[model samples]
Target: MEFSQLIYRKQRRWNLFAIAAIVSLLLFSSLYLMVGEVFISPFSEVTPLMEQLVLQLRLPRLLTAIAIGASLAVSGAVLQVLLGNVLAEPGVLGISGGASVMMVLVLFFIPVFATPVGFMLAAVVGALLFTLLLVSFAQVARLTTTRLLLVGVALGILSGAVVTWAFYFSDDLSLRQLMYWLMGSVGGASWYHHILTLMLLPVLIWLCFKGQVLDKLMMGETHAKQLGIDVEAVRWKLILAVSVLVGGAVALGGVIGFVGLVVPHLLRLSLGSENRYLLPMSALSGAALLVFADIIARTSLDSAELPLGVVTTSIGAPIFIWMLVKNHDSR
Candidate 1:
């Protein structure tokens, strides 16, 4: 194929992907609104209770899925580009682990700090602290990308230990609550959570879009500096953006892993490495994936909803393994 033809073909493919994502989103929304305790047929009957369930219960959950999905995917895309590592994700980098630890602590030790806003603040602080520690350790050790990954893995293990200890010492009720949160569900979503997520989502999206300078930086930090980009300043801003996005999502929906990891990689494979297309495509695809996963979680079993985390992990693990295998084969 000629170069121009190839370019046109790729753009057409992306357009198709975008259309498919929109269709999936609409189908998921309809399914979410229609499937519940009382199946309300759209044309036949519209009762008050049905309206409550659709509007009050399901709408918030759907919106939360969209927010968490978009936020996590964007975080993953930015981190991967910034670190120059395809495997970099919020969960792998210890940000999610740190947020999870603080959330568990709040649930156990501080009853007054159990509100959504309080939990969000705690998670953001913890994520930022851990991110700083990781950066410091990287600088001290003169780390490579591989070394950084190992360090992040180690930090995640340590944070897991802290979370476990917190759970062990907490009351039974608190422990149960913590366990449910950790499992990850949108069942408890409310309008307040929706509002909070909506407020933060646009700002994070803007920051990620603005940080496309990282694409040039991804070639090498030295090259970026030579081109007049303030490398340190950009890195710190990206870190802050990731903290707010990931921390807010974790605070509201607990730690839903693999959405970040999976979404960005898929986008990169299908759409190439351009951050502009990659970021927005990842957002839409991630939102669609999470909404579909949540629907399966809610409606798959008879009268027993599965945890959203379980659903994502079950689907994500196999995909991740495949990607790893493919990467290995390519080398």
Candidate 2:
């Protein structure tokens, strides 16, 4: 296709997908805020206590979910483009793993930093540390793409092993409480948590605007550099972006897995792999899916709630298999 024609096609896809995602997100988010323990209609008659519930509880939770979903999806899309692998995600770079390890430390070893703010701080720091380490490795080792990806996967596994050891050996918290952090949840949502998550929006926005550059990188590093893109600098920026977003997400929602992995792939199948459309659309769809999954997590059980990560992974696993099979058959 001609360059102009490709641009036109991408724009059309963006408009259509954006419209669909907005409608779906608004509908599901409204439903989410309404369908709690007390089934209150969003636009119907209300009481003061109900209003308080909506404001203090449901509203913050919904916002936090949106932030987490959007951040993960965009970061995942960026990583896929950067690493040239569909399986590339937040975990592939160990961002969430680093965050999880820090959270474990705060929960047990550092009692002074057990608050929400403290956890968020520690998580971001750990995430940045691992991300920078990866960048340094990429630079120093002059590793090929496949080798770099392997290194990232290895780091993530190492981080997970450390977290597992901490969870099992420590007696600071109950097994159930610590396990939920690993599985992921938004039940701890509050305005403070919401604010901490919102700080990542600027990074996400900057990344969404980087679709043109990312699209070039998708071609190949040599081709992208020939096209006047600073391939190395963009890689560093995107690495940092993914790290911060994933770190914040882990802090806010725990290690919610599938948003980063599945959202971008689903949109790629439906719309096309043009990053311009994929990035923003992924944000919208991610928000919608997370909010919807959260509703299932909240209402699935009669008495207690299910972990959000389990819910997403359960839903994503089958869909991921189907996607893989379809790709295989198409090839």
Candidate 3:
């Protein structure tokens, strides 16, 4: 096929994928609205209780799930492209670990600072610190993407140890709170949380979109320099943007896993490796995945709801394992 024809075919595929994602999101939203205890069977018979549940409770949760999922997924896509590593995710880079550490500190010291804003601020600080540290390590070591992944793994392990120590020394109530946060859930989602997520997501998404220059940079530092792109500046900016995005999501919903890893990898496989389309498509696909997961979390059991992280892991781990096997085979 001609190069122009291939480009058109790729664009057509992405357009169709985007359309399917929209339709899926709509269906999931409708399902979320419709599947509660106070059931309204028909559209005409929808009552105040159902409306309240849908509008006040379900809608906020749905929006939060979408925001968190999309943020993490977009961040993942950006990191993957920037680092030129398919395995790179926000959580893998210790962003989530950093957030968890700050959250644990707040719970340990100033209990009153456990509010959403305080939590978000702490998470951002932690993530930014880690990002800087990681970048510095990369520079000093002249690290490859594989080396970056190892560094991230080490950081994550160290942070996990810190969190474990904090939990070990805490009281029952504090430990309980920390456990819930670590496991992740959308239980406390409110209009305020929704608003905060909405406000941050757009700015972060725009930054990721702006990082198209990094895509060119990935060809090599020499090539990027030739093209007049400041490779180091772009890398730092992408890191900061991802830190904020992932940190905010962690603050709101705790340490939900796999959405970042799962969504972007799936998109890369389906839509090919263009960050422009991969970023948005991953966001949409991630939102759809989390919304569906949340629906299962709420309605799967008898009285109490399951943790959203539990549901995601239950689904994501097998998929991840399968991908690992496939990757190994390909290699």
Candidate 4:
């Protein structure tokens, strides 16, 4: 009876936490739409200009933030399970890095393919290729978690080197444009970007609903196989889904880092490690975090906007360092 009561209390707490995360997402999203450079009151008398500004400019950016945030967070959660490493994330695994590298190459060398759709497609393909390579390492090479992480870090370094060379060789105008983008911002978001968001949503929803599969996989391959889970097939499907998600996020937000790494880690700490709850809650929490971060990015300065990546990295880096230290100490 005591054990049953304890389980009930824990379930109630998790339910309440989920409700709070959802509420926070909605609240932050509303605040984001209202509190930009020009504060437009939703309750106030209508102005055509205000409506246009709200609908045309802010709404798309908000949607981009929400979509990219949810995508990256869910991808990270699933990657952690797929890789069997708590530290796994799209950015950390070189998925975002690969997407960014492809985007930069296309923008610089293949000017004809510099359109938004073209960029998204390039990013998706790049992410998919990189994900396949990592999957091979995990499945075929049978690398350990630590070695896999090292390989991922090496891929990220290689991608960074390529980006740096591109930065060095570009003319002044292209340099400035690429610099701003690589730093990351959603300020360029428009109705056109909504197509990318549409591409992301189904994959995000599908991944979120895979919590049971993730839970079984979390127990290791042998255990998952014993439970009638086809580990190899599921991993491939998940890799494809994660590629789409990470690719779309990089295309939408321009190499935003640490969101995928940070949001799920924080949720895991407070909410426990049940993927069923963790995945959806990570989506809500991640969306809220990015929206809040964007609010800071645009509004913090008077004239110039700060890069969205800079703001997120600033917030996430410290938490990530603490996490690293904690993990080491625990060991």
Candidate 1 global TM-score? 0.91
* 1-331 per-residue lDDT for model 4 (tens digits): 9999988987887899889888898998899889867898879997998889889999999999998888888888888888777777877778888999999888888989987788888899889988888877987788876688888889888888888888887777966686687777899899998988888888888888899999999888899999999988998899889988988999998888888889888878876888988899889888989999999998999888899989998998898778878877877
Pairwise TM-score winner, candidates 1 and 4: 4
Report, for every candidate in turn, its global Cα lDDT versus the true structure: 0.80, 0.83, 0.80, 0.86
Residue 211 CA displacement from its true place in model 1, Å: 5.8
**Candidate number of the best TM-score:** 4
In order, what is each prediction's RMSD in angstroms?
2.3, 3.0, 2.3, 1.8
Residue 169 displacement in candidate 2 (angstroms)? 2.7
**Which residue window of length 10 is worst by lDDT in model 3?**
36-45
- Which pairs clash in model 3? none
Deviation of model 1 at 132, angstroms: 3.1
- Structural similarity to truth (TM-score) of each candidate: 0.91, 0.88, 0.91, 0.94
lDDT of 2 at 28: 94
- How close to the true structure is residue 99 of candidate 3, measured as C-alpha lDDT? 83
User: What local lDDT does model 3 show for residue 305?
Assistant: 85
- Candidates 1 and 2 compared: the better one by lDDT is 2
TM-score of 2: 0.88
> lDDT score, residue 290, model 4?
93
Largest lDDT belongs to which candidate?
Answer: 4
Candidate 4 regions off by >4 Å? 139-147, 172-175
Q: Arrange candidates, best lDDT first.
A: 4, 2, 1, 3
lDDT of 2 at 112: 89
